[model samples]
Structures are given as structure tokens and as C-alpha cells.
Target: MSGDHSTYAPRSGFTKWIDTRLPLPRLMHDSFVSYPVPRNLNYAYTFGGILSIMLGLQMLTGIVLAMHYVASTDQAFTSVEFIMRDVNYGWLLRYLHANGASFFFLAVYLHIARGLYYGSYKAPRELLWILGVVILFLMMGTAFMGYVLPWGQMSFWGATVITGFFSAFPAVGDWIQRLLIGGFAVGQPTLNRFYSLHYLLPFMIAGVVILHIWALHVTGQTNPTGVDIRKKTDTIPFTPYATIKDALGMSVFFLVFAYFVFYMPNYLGHADNYIEANSLKTPAEIVPEWYFLPFYAMLRAITFNLGPINSKLGGVLTMFASILVLFVVPWLDTSKVRSAVYRPVYKVCFWLFIVDCLLLGWCGSQPPQGAIVLTAQLGTLYYFGFFLIIMPLLGLVEKPRRLPNSITEAVLSRRQTSAGRPAGATAAPEDRG
Candidate 1:
């Protein structure tokens, strides 16, 4: 039974109290009622929700771990050990934080890929995708710095190698390097700064993600079918529909996460990090985490160091640019069609881009040997070309096949006709190869 609006007036007591303090109704309306989200937003859209939940997990587990962590280089390694040995349920926090980073990235990359596939970055949704890019950069920076806080060998050298990328800029290269390291090298001062920054960046990511959500909310979500939402008939309330999809998606994602936690938690970790940090000694193969490897490979691809230009700053700039180039993807992609399925030329380039990234990642882990250097050069060229050259070209030259008139038609046509199931109705994903 519903209350009679004619007999009701504005609340004066507990309703007012809750409205002023929590504003639950307003939040519910904004999130579920007023928002007109697409009906066909498949599994990909759930990644953004999963990412939001994982960020909360990271913050909680990180805070608890930080309580046991010593920022000092002298005790940082021992503190990790002490947590393992002394603190109650410390391993849970540590495992959660470490694997949580991987899961966060997993969700983000999927979210971005979803955007890429759906043309979610075009026009009104451009700012949302851009915000996601910025959030990505923040996540990378946060992860890089956080890896160093453990005061392990891989942590130290990985920090050195990655921070060294900043020197790619002219003039202030050395100064930036010293500032980052807090001296000429990674030591106690570097550990302290990294610790402080690592703690601070998650909050920064949260702030950016708020902007990301706002941007996404303004334009709503993109679906796999690249259909547009124009009227109430074309859309559904964001709640029960999108919420259920998000819930299911998170459940699947957590299954993958649980597998990592239970079976291969340390599979993502480096062995050298088991050792304590030492300024005097360095690991023979001090590679950054797998996520940073592609960019790292890009930096090493450039062999000639030009004085201070060739210093740590140059390395830093090259590395940062590797991902920074991503922010401009919407501009680079010239095709009018948003879906990769529609663009034959674009789809092939997409796979090449994936290959280039994997090759670059592989080469980054190798020493700067003769063959590896050559391979890195090829991969680097392809990497830049994928975005800078191919994407722009595909936009101009490629002809997009006819697209569906609307999202509803696209979703309906897939089901069937009264005549019977047409060819490819309820079809499996074609092997685009």
C-alpha cells in the first residue's frame, strides 16, 4: 500500500535527519532510478563495478598491512617478515593487497578493452574513457611505488629501473632522478618517499575514479552491440538490470581471484623480492612487475644516451609516454564505426597491437643483448605505429559495414524471426582470424 501524497507534507524529524546526513533516497535515485542505462550491457560493463569493489579491498587490506609495515629501510624487510611471523592474519592482508593489485589491473584493462570494443570513448563518453586512462596511469604509478615498499631486491631495482624513465625529458633529468631517489640512488630516503607516496596514491585513484563514475554516469554505459539509447523505450532503469549483471560479473571475477589466492598467489610475485633491500648490491635481473614490462621494453629499445638527455629523465619520459599515448586513442582512431566487429581492417590491427604489447613485455624482461635489442626495436616501432599511424589511418581509409539502426533492433535481430532462426542467430563469436 502506498501513502497518500495529498495528506503528506515534508518530513520534519527522522526523515529530515536521514536526508541531511545520508541522502540515501537521492543516491538511490541517481544510481538506479533517474539513470537510463542500456539493456544489453553484457559482461564487459561489469568490470568497472568489479574494479570499484577491488579498489575498496585494496585500500582496506593496505591500511591494515601498513599498520604492521615499517617505512624505514632498516626495518622494512624485517617488518614484512614479522607480519608473516607475528601479526594475526597478516598473510591474508598481504596476499589480498598483492593479488588485489593484479585483479584491479585485470578489471581495468577489461574495462578499457570494453570501451575500445564498443566505441564508448566517442563523443559524449570521451571524457569518461579519458578519466579511465588517467586512473590507469595513477594505478601504474601507485603499483610501481608500492612494489618498492617491501624493501626487497626486485623492489629496489624495479624502482630504480622504472623511476629512471623520467630522465627522458631535457635539462631537469638528473634533478628529477635525485628527487625521486632522495639522493643519487635508491636507499633509505627512497624507501620513505615510496612508502609515503604508495599510501597516498590509492586515495588519488579514488578521487579520479569518482570523476570516472561521474563521466560515465553523464553519458551512461556502452553495450557490446554499439547501439544508441535515445528514449525510455530504448533503455531500462540502471538498477535491477545493470546491477544484476554487475553482481554476476563480480562473482565470476572473484572466482578467478580466489584461484590466484588459493593456488598461485605468489605466481605474480618475483623471487628476488624475498631478499632485503641493499644499496650496495643489485639483483642480476632486476625486472619490474609484468604490468610495467611492455613500457620498460620500450625504454630500453632506445640505446643511445645523449648526455643528460640520455640520463634517468629520458628513461622516465619514454616510459610514461608509453601509456600516456593511450589517452589520445579516441582522436587517433579515425573510423566512424565504434565496434571492432564492424571494422575488418581495424580488427586485424587490434590483434597486431596485442602481439606488439606481448612482444614488448617479453623483451623488457631480457638483457639488452643483440637479438633482443633488435626485437625490442621492431616491437617499439609497431607499438607506436599501432596508435600513431595505423589507428589514424584506419579511421580515414576503412569503410565500416552497415550498422544496426538502434540498440533494440540489434539485440532483437540476434534472437530469431517467425520464419525460423536465421543464419548466425544466437551465434558463437566468429574466429576473426
Candidate 2:
């Protein structure tokens, strides 16, 4: 699916001259306009484009908020208040930026789940998947730092608690923690550094997004049928089909984002974050944002220590391993089939994994005690076990149903069935060929 290298014919003298110097327009035309997309692709494919729009929205709103935000520990909380009351439309900008982070993560999770279902990470698309994981890591870092910029009770204590994770390291633990916060605790230095990094990392994510799209163009897209394009009829030009679909997806996504920003701006945020920072007072229960909850639950689930390793270090390792496990997922599933649509057993396990994640998230939001702790422990076990044992074993044991011969065939069959004809009915000579 590597791009066709055919030169673009300039339509005018201006474009001809520009093309001679730099062919950026031609590159765009080839990459997005004339690119071939599988005709059988479903709505799940739109999340990638929606994620791109969300990234742009986040950067725009973040820049505006940064203009009014103060990073100093002394003025940070008061400055946020000032922006809400004094700066023009500042509340709107702040809400958009805050809620945008949640929406961004929501879209990314959907995108990842879609990829897993369709096997988008297999074979030629491995680099594309790796780039996406890198983007996710960068987004997590950027969001963590941005949360600290508000200097609210949750922001300050959250920073301290998260940075303290580095202390789980052996001899260098203290030094690592100090390096992260710039002192023994979260203070002016920590705020300034987080602000700087929060501002810088989005552009880095944008740079990686370019590589991800390039990789996508090289491998093309995996369709619902999980079959490679074998003929011209199997695909449609990206311009009219995919571009229009992406535009519609973006519109729907913004409607949901606007609902959160306008109706319940603080719905996704913790109540504790509304209060100014007080080092002497810790919140009754410390919790990260909803997006980080599953991993947070994993971190707190470990209560016992192995020889020379305490529970704190074990929990930290367990949390990090949950994400790192995804890096090797392409190699773990040994099935020749791509889409889970034909793999009955894998589909059931996939939904179970999703439920386990949701359960872990709920456990993370609660205090680590009683039945919740036990539930989280079990959820965390399934989380790791699904990736490590279930995926590999299922691939070898599950028998996938026969796949459609091609994307065109799949689409034709669906159309025929919708028209009340049997899927196996005779097709036109051209379609059959």
C-alpha cells in the first residue's frame, strides 16, 4: 500500500513553479486526496481523524489558557481564579482545555480498541502502532504536567504523590524523586518545570502524529473484513469517502465536547481541585484523573512484598508493565486472521478485557479498602493475564471463520443481503472477476 509515486500535474503557472521548488501540495494530494481507502471501512475508522481534530483543539485552547495562567506557586491558584473572572472568555477557554484532555483520551481509547479488533497493528503496520503508543505516552506526560499547573489541592498533592513513585527505585530512589520535583516536595520549582514541559510536549506529539500518518499511508488501512485490497474496485478515493466521513465525525465529536464544556465543565474533575493548595491538609482520598484510573488501580492493588522488593515498588512496576505490554502485542497474537469479527472466542475475551479495565477504573476512584480492594486486585490480575496468557493461547486454539475474499466482495455481499438477496447469489461478471 505504499504511495504511488506518480508526479502531480500542476493546474497553473503558480502551482508549477511552487511544485518545482517544494511539492508539499502534491504530497498532501497524494497522501489524502487520491489515496485509496478500503470501501468496507466502518465508523470505527473515523476515530483517528477525530483524534487529530482533538489534538488541534487541545493545543489551541491550551495556548489561550497559558496566556492567562501563572506558573508561580504563590500566584498560580489566584491567577486561575482571575482568569475565570477577569480575562475575556477565559473560563470558556480553560474549560475547553480541561475537558478536551478527557475527550482526547476517550477518542484514543476507542481508536486503540478499534485497532485491536481489526488487527491494525499486524505485519506492515507495526511502526504505525508503535508511533501511536508513543503519542499516548507523550499525551499522558503532558496531561500530568498540565494538571499540576493549576496549583490546586489535588494538583499539588497529586504531583507530590506521582513523583514519589520514583522513590520506589532502590539506591537512587531519593535522587530520582528530588530530580523530578526539584526539591523534597512539590513547590515553585516543580510548578515552573511542569509548566515548561506541559507547554513543550504537545508539539512533540504533533511531530510524532506526522510520522504515524505517514506510516498509515504506507500500509493503507485495515478494513472490517481484514482482507487486503486486491483490485481497484476494493477501494475508494480518500478525498470524497474518507474525508467526508472524517468531517462528520469531527462535528459529532465537537458536539460532545461542547456539551461537557458548557453544561458540566467540572463533571470530569475532582472537587478537591477547586480548593487552593494546602501542604498541611491532604484530601481524604487521592485519585488521579479518570483517564489514569485503571493504571492507578493496578498500582494500588499490590499489597504484599517479594523478597528485597516492597509493595510500593511492585505496584509501580505492575502499573508500568500494563502499558509496556501493549508494545509487544503484535507478536503475542499468533492468528493469521486480523479482525475479531470472525474469531468468536477472541471477541468474547476482548469484551471481557474491556470490562476488566472499567472495573479497575471504578476501583481506582474508591479508597483502597474492603471489597473494592479485592475487586481491584482481581481486575488487575485479569488485565495482565489477558494480554500475556489469553491472547497468545487463544490465537493458537481459536478457529476463525472463513474471511471474505476481498473488500469488494465483502461490500457486495452486504449490499446483496440488505437488498433481500442471498449473499451467495450470482454476481455480475465484472464483480466476480
User: Relative to the true structure, how large is the alpha-carbon lDDT of every model?
Assistant: 0.80, 0.90
Score every model by TM-score.
0.89, 0.96
Residue 233 accuracy (lDDT) in model 2:
97
For model 2, residues 247-327, the per-residue Cα lDDT tens digits are: 988888889889999999999999999899999999898899999999999999999898888999999999889999888
**Span of 10 residues, lowest total lDDT, candidate 1:** 1-10
Q: Which regions of candidate 1 fall more than 4 Å away from where they truly are?
A: 1-13, 16-24, 304-316, 417-419, 422-433
> Across residues 284-376, which tens digit of lDDT does each residue of candidate 1 receive?
887888877888888888776666565344555666677888888878787778888788888788778777888998998898799998898
> After best superposition, candidate 1 residue 278: deviation in angstroms?
2.0
Candidate 2 stretches with Cα past 4 Å from truth are: 1-7, 421-433
**True lDDT of residue 322, candidate 1:** 75
What is residue 358's positional error in candidate 2, in angstroms? 0.7
Strongest candidate by lDDT: 2
Q: Model 1 reaches what TM-score against the true structure?
A: 0.89
Q: Best-fitting candidate, measured by TM-score?
A: 2
For residue 133, give model 2's deviation from the true position in Å.
0.6
